[model samples]
Target chain A: MSALLTVEGLRHGFYGVQVLNGASFEVRQGTVTGLIGPNGAGKSTAINAISGALLPQGGRVSFAGTDITRLPPRERVGLGLVRSFQLARGFPRLSVFDHLMLYGQGHPGEGFWQSLTGGRAGRQHEERLAETALSVARRLKLDHVIDNPVSALSGGQKKLVEIGRALMAEPRMILFDEPMAGVNPTLSAQIAEHLTALNEEGITICLIEHDMAMVARLCDPVIVMAEGRKMTEGSFAEVVADKAVQEAYLGVRHDA
Target chain B: MLSYVIFSATTAGIYGLLALSLNLIWGGAGMVNLGLAGFFAVGAYASAILSLAGVPVPIAILAACAMGAAAGIGATWATVRLRGDYHAIVTLGFAEVVRLVAMNERWLTNGTDGLPGIPAPLKSVLGPQGFAVFYLCLVLTILVAVFLALRRLDRAPFGRVLKAIREDQDLAGFAGKNAMRVKLIAFAVSAGIAGLAGALYAHYQSYISPDHFQPLLTIYIFLAVTSGGVGRPAGAFLGAFLVILFLEGTRFLGHLLPGLSSGQVAASREILVGLAFLLVLHLRPQGVLPERIRPAPAQ
Candidate 1:
């Protein structure tokens, strides 16, 4: 399979405390690759470096064979490399529909002067964006609360909205940071299914998930890490069976 | 008496415009722009100087707007990298610098003597009293245009993204928004509006001075923004109108306090304005009209 994302010798730290050290991995196109690690094993740091959230002091990140290590996070997003937060960031005062609308691209009506002169083309653009926003809201089952403030959303619903926003960008790849956190089992399962559906439709995904069972069910070519370095890579069963992976997870019995 | 009411209403509209401009920065973009009076001064002075140099009134006003936008963009370039309170402090200092320039640059601003003979378009056609009425109408019309522009922004996708950035800068970036560019555009546009209001004030009064753009002017705008509500254009206009009413309403205090001097009444009115803002903050922190997020009903 062709690789869509590649990281090499990435290193980052905060205030003299190193979080990611010489971490490298590849996410192939059209697959959900999982990154698993114990606490402080640099999963988030690695994702941050990849997504341009934390510009690494050393190492390189390439997307679709182009160097993007120094690109600003916003520029990276414009190139269709997007990322989501573990806590599911949302503007509390904005409505769910507004959150979705904010993510709509190619609308000149969002410009200051263009907004004043919103002609036939602008109105049509808005109508199209509205349609897409509606479809996204419905797909996420957020239609019920579409008019409500984001503050009113449940934790699981916020996670879904976060994903919905990423989808609005028409992403090529998404780096998900613990999207399953704080979600009920059913909702989490639905999230996994939605991700699988996305993968089937040719979107590359790299997620940092703590739930090993969900990871085993959803991700192929699971990447494992220990002490901020690559430990192993294989199918979930193969990685879990590896002695190094077991010891990294403290004999693999502690979690169960 | 009716004319006097119109005069007061026109003044209120000017304040409304000023308040709304500041609201764009503080409420929409979550950036505290404390140099409001600086932009106002730039507009007033640039228009005054240009008109005195024989430029037409409309052209002078446009130039003032450009000058204000430049100043706003310049301020952003200098300090946009600074986060939060630091940006606020730098903007506050900016207003003081403009005031000092107006004071020290006596050759242009005429120092404390102030600029007289500021041109008005209708002054020749309508004559003094008729011009006053016509000017009020003109100012109100400009306020309406400004109101419509700001109101549109309040509901537009651009404003939504601004609020998004206000909530989470990191996430806004991931949403493909160039946060700094959005902020600069919003901030500069706001400052340009403040400049427009200043030009109106200068032309209406037929004079301009440094004291006219004092930091207290910025304070009054902050009060208007807080009292009317944040993030809503109507709130900015409403708060400014109410601020004028509360201050002007004190004119009737002569009957209630027979022994009080007009001077005393004026001083007390200022105090009352301050106290009313404090009370509004304590009782209704959201202003009289709180922010509302426009959402299309789910179909």
Candidate 2:
């Protein structure tokens, strides 16, 4: 499969300390790509730069063969590339349904004047979006709490809301920043099942995860990052068995 | 006494208009527009100048709205990247600069002397008492229209985008929403509302000065929004009226305590207003009427 996203020579720093130093990788189309590294491996930063949330100091990011290095996050999303947060960020006061509806495809009554003086077409569009949102909620088992404010949701449920929001965008590729972080094991497995199900449906995904077992289960062509750069790329088992990947996670012993 | 009540109510209506605008930017979009007075001054002066130049009052007010929108968009564009407290400081500075320009630019603003004799709409035909009643009706009509329009906008997709941006701008951006454009439009509409209120104030009072567009007016509006409810349009309207009542009621203190100097009475009034604001915040941080999420339609 061809690469849907390509990041080369990605570099970033904060206050003179580098976080992402020449990180390079590619997420192939229709694959659940895993990005794993030790603490401070710049895994989050790498996805952020690729997602256009944080502009890298130096790099090239091509999405669907277009060089989108300088595109804003909104434009990137318009191109069908979307990302989720590590901690499930959302509008606190917005209900789960509204949150999903806010990210619906094709803004219908979104114009300044059109919103104030809404028409039959806008109402019709909204009704269709409501149905879509309802389906997404039902799929995620969030139908019961569809009208509950996002802040009132449990951590696991909020994580589901984030996924539901991404789904609402009808994205071609989704970069998830630890979607299962802080989630219980049962929900984590459910999220794993959802990711597998989504991958089967042809949506490309790149995920940053610390749960090695979950990563091993869900990811293919796993890319291991160490010291802000891609250390190795292979199947999960191959990367795990590599000496360099082991050393990166566990420091070299001076006594030996 | 009836006239006084009518006059106060009319002024409160103007404040309600201003409060509504502020609520859109501050509550809906999560922008701290401390330079609301700048937009107010821009609208008031634009209308006042155009009217003085023999333009029709309605046309002048429309021009003022345009100018206010331009000012709001320009100001927001310049400082959109500043986060949180920095944005507030820059907006505060913007208001100060506007005040200074109004103070120094005698060629346009007539310096600190200010412009007088602003022509009131329907003043000649209705006469004084009738005009007062007519003007009150006009202001109330405009306020209610704005209130209804804002409520509609708040329920539409536009308002949902604003709320998403307010919660987390980056998340909203990733949702394929242009947060910058949304915020710019929000600021423009809000500034237009403030501008409209300013024009109305100029016409009603038939006089306006830099003193009338004080930063203190912005603070009072903030207090009113906080007291009423942050995100609710009805809360802003009620809060404005409540604030005006408190402000006017304080005048009785000087009459009751004749021994107190006028300066002392003024100081005490400030203290009393501050105490009232604090009491409201202490009791209801969410305001008197917190924002309520609308219920979902039945599937």
Q: Best-fitting candidate, measured by TM-score?
A: 1
The sequence of per-residue lDDT tens digits that candidate 2 reaches over residues A131-229 is 899989999999999989999999999999888888888899999999999999999999998888888988999999887899889999899888889
By DockQ, the best candidate is 2
Q: Residues B42-145, candidate 1: write the lDDT tens digits.
A: 99999999999999999999999889989999998899788689999999999999999998889999988889999988799888889889988888898889
Candidate 2 lDDT, B1-46, residue by residue in tens: 9899999999999999999999999989998889888888888988
Chain A TM-score, prediction 2:
0.96
TM-score, chain B only, every model? 0.96, 0.97
- What's the TM for chain B in candidate 1? 0.96
Residue ranges of candidate 1 with Cα displaced over 4 Å: A250-256, B258-261
**lDDT for each residue of candidate 1 in A3-112, tens digit (9 for 90 to 100):** 99999988888899877788888999888999998888999988888888888989999999989999998788878898889888888888888888777766677776
Displacement of the residue A167 alpha carbon in candidate 2, Å: 0.8
Runs in model 2 deviating more than 4 A are A14-18, A250-256, B253-263
